[model samples]
Target chain A: MTDDEVIHMEHVWTRFGENLVHRDISLSLGRGQILGVVGASGCGKTVLMREMIGLQTPTQGQVWLLGESLAEADARRKQQLRNRCGVLFQGGALFSALSVFDNIAFPLRELKTLDEELIARLVCMKLAMVGLGETDALLMPAELSGGMVKRAALARALIMEPEVLFLDEPTSGLDPVLGEEFVGLLGQLHRELGFTVVMVTHDLDTLSDLCTCVAVLAGQQLVSYGTLDDAIACAHPFARDFFHGKRAQRILGRSD
Target chain B: MLASQSSAETSALPPLSPPEFAVEDGTAVVHGHWNLRGLIAASPDLRERLCRAARRPDLEWDLRGVNVLDSAGAFVLWQAWGERLPERISLRHEQQSAFRRWQTGGIPAVRDGRRPPVPIRRRIIAAIAGLGSHLLAVLALLGQLILDLAHLARHPADIPWREISATIHETGGRALGITALVGFLIGVVVSYLSSLQLKTFGAQVYIVNILGMSIIRELGPLLAAILVAGRSGSSMTARIGVMRVTQELDALAAMGISQSLRLILPKVVALVVALPLLVVWTDVVALAGGAVSAHLELEIGYHQFFQKLPAAVPVANFAIGLGKAAVFGLFVALIACHYGLRIEPNTESLGNETTNSVVVSITLVILIDAVFAILFRGVGIR
Candidate 1:
């Protein structure tokens, strides 16, 4: 395990009955570093980050977080570590019954002991950080548009002021203009908070602009992992096809 | 092996690999290493062949020559009769070791026999555990309620009486008329049934005593509680389940709000406050209906029924019945909320649990009534 690493997956293998989704895969995330995991739909990038947050246990391997093995963490320790690692789910998993203010105030209420006034102020700040106005706080989840809901969800995830954030398909349903805006907001949040960000996305255009490091998942392994420049410089067919939007048939010179 | 003969006949037949079965004298015999994956791969063919051979009435699965089987393969053969094939495909075992393994709990993945699988033995244990968990949750909520009420008692100026009154009206007052009607019908039934036996003994006056005692002591509170359990209990559960499915509970968890305090405690407190009043109302209406029935059928005078009613059911009877109502109300509210909040993502679970909450609440109410009867009788309070 590296000293500065926030996440470490050593020889991780995950399986679902007869299907093996990941096999002997290993990767690490250093402090304040952003790792963009790019893969096709069934390649198991989401499961890797889920392991990092201790949401899933590897079938055959170990997951270590901040120098402590997650396998051995007690409930209290696990809760604390989970509070430190915030997650924004793929479909903007906001609580539909709660107003945006309650959504943003949830993590603070769960893990911190702050006065109501302070919680209100912090909620507004977090909301404003995501480009959602103060007036948007009282609206329920169903009332918001797709982009606004994502912003609200992001605000909720960051309520604890976590040291690391996991975003799954952050730009999944948004148009390009709003998707790029969300990425820019993430960039600003990273610049200000200096927290490590791990994003699992199929959107390859995000790699050059936002991600510092990229890992391409194929054949149930992290086939190539390094800086974006390294990924571009590599000659693997999967990475080449993914980054350039080359169809599998064009790259392989034959259709399957 | 039939592979050599078939290979000569057709070149395109994919050469039947190593594990082959040969037909000799109209009987097929197979031999090879049998692993779970290989057996699963040939399941379609095995199922077709088994169905054809086992079409006879009272079929027996002859696994005498089978070497080894895993849980999946065993279940496929075992479950095919009831689950898939539906005819008489009984599993017959002449081997001692295999029979012993089957009897001695070698099976790992057998489905529970109960449709919803609330096993009698396990449900008894779960009931005890569920009771303990409910008691703990109640104690915690009651402690908070006590603290809040104490604070309100200390500073009456901060109390929101209008809001409290509105909530009470919504939860209790609106339900009062229906509760009274149900109690009145129960009282009429009790009086009518008692008059039947009392007329033969020429003890018609005692019909007044029976109706007054049963309604005030037992049926009034019990019937009203069952009705509420069906109505409000189900409503409470559905409300919580919808909130849970929508991730409102997750939001509450995130915001650091104790869901028990925010959602359950207030509703429980409301029902607790309302149930005793409802029992009192129901008792009055039921006794009036009993008096009407007694006057009509038994030829007992209205004045006589009224005069003997107070003496028959003492004030202590009403008090004890109200206490039962309080406990029953708490059980109904807690069970409904618990099951509702525990709903998984499936809609089937929601529907089933809503029904289960009503059944469990009513069953517990009756069981607790029996225990209370023993306790009250022991204390000479009856």
Candidate 2:
């Protein structure tokens, strides 16, 4: 099971002082699969994503990325594993000081293995793939619109060609047009690049279209985990309300 | 905790195989893990080797024996061959799919890393414009503060003394201990040093004049101002900067609340009130410290030092110190609030502005003190 898993979390609990954000949570993501994480506000979906990426660690239990336990991997192993994955933090955490091109080239430069010439070309290609023009590369993060910032962040996340990509709330603040366009881009990149993606999001269209599986977090535990249809059919109260909610029903084109 | 974070304790690159190449009969044979993991270890050697290989008439990616190939590995291999199927090559199902993705998808081709450079003159002009805009906005905020103060004076009941007093308690009252500690320490060092020089001249009695004039008039207010600038001033800028980044300031503005009255005015008023009092407190503590040090070093009793201090340093010097403290306090708070309000909606701006607030205010305090020293030259020379 561990050999085939890209991400695996077991009995994970995250507590800030006295408040427990997650409890008794366990889940696994298969290789080459898209897993959409969803929950109500404050339910710790993003916390789970952070744990998998080693940005956050659980107070109890384990988080394994690409089959190596993050808590156990040595520095060298962790660095190797990190190079195999990418993360798009909430609000597109691009460095405000660097230009868009520099932000995208950041990981390549850090790897210390690639020449500037190759890094530049890779940055340009990523910009093009994310629907941004070459000219946009010179603009700073502050200069870009929200959608453009997200796209530029996405391009930066992809520059390394990681085997796994994790996104936190990829479409929350985007307008509907850009939201749809982003989902389309995600699908296209996932297919073309053949990387596993774990997105923490509440967007219904993304859940239905881009995700191969949906994991619902609620009441300090994973309430539901499966395909979108499985979530809609789940008996848990929050899962039922979420899938059969008026907005979700309208988006899914279902009467009940 | 990844490499991109840079703050991670692990700074060394992981050892992985850089792609290896060999020349064979005017052909290049490439082999190794160019997979998701191996590509992270791409070094100058691999690039140079690849570049040299690209010149070969026939290049072959003998992938039949190699393992660990992914998009990154395949992409680099494709790039080495100039994004085309090589003149002669080997075949495998996984390797074929990797190359096919490159053919069909977006991959950056190799090229010189160069961007059209901006002329130095243009950069300098842009920088000057930015600085000019910042200064102008700060002047505008100063005008708004004056108007708010006038309005509050006319309608005294509308003043938010509750918030203003609370801010004073938090920023000023809590700062007393550290201020006293540092001020006393500074006084001790100054007196001890003066005693050394006075002893050499056998004029130990004049230590009273030196300590009294410097601590009461110059060092006390300057020390207090610098301490507050570091402690309270940075905190004020950081608090307001965070409010801007989180859009709490926007929420206040949206509800038609006057930010000047509800936010900026209280901070400015609190500092203006707290600072002069703090300077007085600092002066008293420093004098006591100097008297104690003088007694220990010069065997001149506290009674003698205290008696001589009044005649040596005039009350006019103390008044000048008070005046400088008030002005310094006002400028520090105003500069802090100006930078805080100007913080862009980003985390980077919050840190940058907080640093600027403390640094710029401290520099201005010294400059202003120099101007005061020149203007009051005759008054404090008793």
Candidate 3:
């Protein structure tokens, strides 16, 4: 069942100053699965993503992205892996100076040596994939709505049609409706594009609806990670409460 | 609907009106006014239809009288604008500010908290930045000398005499008046002090020796360098530091450029090369004033003062003084570059570093002067 492990971290340890934020963590992400990491604020979700993206080095462990250890990879190989893995930072960290088109085109430009005509075509196509079209391309980051910014960030992440997509709190500030829609979009992209998705969020609604497998970070380890029904069936007080909170919405089908 | 509310009662709340929208001369005029709670409860159809009309191929939003909008309301208007409006489009009423709470693409009432962090890497960079300045100055001077030698070796005729004359006029002749004024005041102070102390010993003739030796060996170079550092070094730091904070340094890095080569190298080279010449100019003027002061106050004639001066100050004094000035110039440039590149991206950091740079540079200059004094005395050059 090993479908070409896209990301593998064996006994990873990350320490900031004197505090060990992530310790002896081993995680493997397969090619076409959605992995959801659920944790409260400051639970080292972003730190984990940083290690995956090769922005931070682990204290003492190994990390492999696309079959190559990130530490041992040459500059060209590292860049190639980075291009292959797209990251959507929390707060939709779109470069404010660039137009929406250029924001999506940033990775494309950085990676591919394409002419302007080809770049424009690719940028438009990516925007359209995120339910944004050619009309939304020329607007700057400051000119897009929150929903649009999220969409643009998504488009930017998918511009290279990356093998893996990492989204950090993609639905933090959004309302229930928009948040649900954003999750739905993530689901659609995953199904259609078949890119491995690893999302870090704390929304219970997202966990129940969108996630195929859920992992909870508590007590300094993944306390629970399984299919929603399987995890709910576990006889733990915290797990029971978490499942009940999610069940209240689906059975009642009420906004309240 | 509320639990007790009947169909008629719920309907009586008020049937929603049609969405009103208009576009004229690149300006979008969306006309809708709903109270806070009403829009929150209203259907999305009217909002969506209105947005579709406003979302013109070539138009901007003019949300002048928007009464209230939730996330849904904001999204509708945003969609209508076809998302092409520049940030200049704004809502006129105060109530609209409330609507912008969760919106994007326009001026939000609360500020966006998306500014990139001022990288701590810059502070870590300051140690190397000092050495960078010195190395750059030496490199620039070597480069210029090499180019001059190359020209002379290749085709000496290309070195125009007119250009050399112009350079002298700008560097020496144009600078003479200010240099004389500064040097003369220093000379008067030295002469006046020597006269005060020497009247006890009846050795006022030695006042000429004191003025000549001190001005040539130390005071002239130190004073000139301090003045220039105050005038130019502070300015260079402020300019570079401001640029650094404004993301100009980041821009340069992104462009794959060496900010030190582009910014630090030139200023360091100019100051180090110019300091010795300014010292020599200051020495000449200070001596002129010393002769005038001796003649008027000490009863030693100008001719007598000049006659004794050559014997009092050896060639070693001039050499030691110029050498000290060169070192001081290097110190000023290094400190300025260090502080400039160390600037964090905020006005507070800019102001603090600017003040710190000036104070630090001057203190280092004085400390360096003490070191020079010790070294020169040890070498028997003083």
Candidate 4:
């Protein structure tokens, strides 16, 4: 793997009992690129993403992240690798027992170096960046609205200033306006920090608006992986149907 | 400049330099990577140096040599400079935005001003008020339960038999093993201790009277109720609390379903039906345990102990135990459902309410047992 390659998978196979999810899937994501993985429901998009992040082991083959082989890394080395990446799960999995402030402060507190005062300042800055205020900090995760929960989860994800971020359906539950705002915030942060992003999304707007590269998964493999236009022009039946479908046509056409 | 320094290494990037600042000729020159990792690696010393440099009234800041600056680094500098930019400073173009973002959006205050401690008198008053509110809420729940029962009585077809059966299996069938173990052990202990005393007074034959009266009329129902309250009551509260957290209760309401009828009534009905049977099972097991211990310690035959139990304790006592068991079951179910409905949509509240449900149910069960003892004082005892 190249030094700039943030994620690399070769001949990765995922099988659940008798069902095969991925067959000989090989893909690589470079530094500072937003790569969107799109596929139909139950097509192993989440499983594939989970495999890339070392959360799940593929039945066969290898996956490397940030020049470290996931299969070869020990627990401590794996922990160090995990520190450099962030993930925003589909359900905004904030610690329900903690307030928003503590939730965002959790990762930094684990470092055991920074003082509470500095941590608080940093947490406040992140909350501001994500369009939350001081009052929102004291509220529990269960008290937050759907949009607020997403924002809070995003703040926690970016707390460590990770080199890479993995988002699972970042804008799925949000309305269009909130979704657009979230995509805008994501794009701005990406430009400023220049971190790599690997996102699994079904929203065409998110895929078209923020993704620098698109990978289409169908028929148990990566059918297309390239620029948006390259993915749209792919001759694969699933890829064509996905990119040239009515919803995709309207959204992609507007973007053009 | 540090980017070039990092790129100069071909195979692996050199370790990042921690943020450092030096006051050179009336200018505070700051350099190195000002990111989270770099700052953390040099936290205590770097923070002191930055604060000390920030204290100089005449020092101009120069940050042109810094290669990286994230929000954390920006925050450290922002805080050290007294939450504002230094009057005279030079920053690299890329690094300027990090500081600028903070300027445009005013820094949010982290700590709310210190809250004064409540006065002692007010604290007591607040405690009393909280108790009053809880009492009222419990009463309100009981009212709703009565209305639900009336509705079910009128519309027998709408009664939730399936849910009631499921709850019975959960609370009654699953609890038999634990209740039997505890009841048998208590029975054995009481019988053995009483036999030792009776042997001293030459009253060993009266062990049957002691064991039968206590186990049948009091200990049997009390032990079963307490165990069920601790085991099933907490679970019921947690189940409803989680439903509240996930907004499932609201969903049910939106679909025009009565929560009390569906959720609360089933548990109440099931416990009422189940606890009496459990008490009977516990009474029989405990009496058998007592008989075994009596035979061993006092040399009384099993046939003699069994034959004397009926004549020793009247049938009125058995009826009273069953009645007390039914009452305890009713209250335990009511208290569990009460706390379950009162839970707020948060995990901390869920935990607190579940604990309260078990504790309150057990306490109420004991209190009701005392009331029954006074009310039925002359009926069962010889």
DockQ scores of the candidates: 0.02, 0.40, 0.01, 0.42
TM-score of each prediction: 0.44, 0.88, 0.43, 0.91
Model 3 ranges with Cα > 4 A deviation? A1-3, A233-241, A246-256, B1-382
Off by over 4 Å in 4: A254-256, B1-14, B21-31, B53-65, B78-91, B112-130
**Would you list the clashing residue pairs of candidate 4?**
none
Number of the top lDDT candidate: 4
Winning model by TM-score: 4
Q: What would the per-residue lDDT of candidate 2 be over residues A1-256, giving only the tens digit for each residue?
A: 4446788887888899999999899888998899999899988888888899887779998777876778877887777788778889889999987888888888888867666866776677778789887667777788899999999999988987888999999998999999999999999888777889999998999999899999989898888888888888888898888888899889999976
lDDT string, candidate 4, A102-150, tens digits: 9999999999988788788778888888899988888888889999999
* lDDT of each residue in B1-382, candidate 2, tens digit only: 3223322322433335756667777646566666645665555477657756776755555667555666567667777677777767776766787677558765444243346789999999999998898789878888999999899989999899998999888767998998899989988999999999999999999998999899989999999999999998898898888898788998999999998899888988888888888999999899889888989999999999999989999899999999999898888888888889888876678888999999999999999999999999999795
Q: Write the residue-wise lDDT of candidate 1 on A1-256 in tens digits.
A: 4457888778999998989999898888899899999887888899988988899998998777765577766787677578667899987788765678887777666544344544565566566568777567777677789899899999888866667899999998999899888888899778756779999987655666688888888889888899976776567777767755554334324332
lDDT per residue for candidate 3 within A5-100, as digits (tens), equals 777777888788888777678878778877788655676878887888898888888777766677776787688578667889887888766777
Native contact recovery (fnat) for each candidate is 0.00, 0.24, 0.00, 0.50
TM-score of 2: 0.88
lDDT of each: 0.71, 0.83, 0.68, 0.89
Ranking by DockQ: 4, 2, 1, 3
Tens digits of per-residue lDDT, candidate 4, B197-295, equal 999999999999999999999999999999999999999999988898789999999999999899998998899999999999999999989988999
**Model 3: pairs clashing at backbone N, Cα or C within 3 Å:** A142-B105, A143-B105, B55-B80
Model 1 accuracy (lDDT, Cα): 0.71
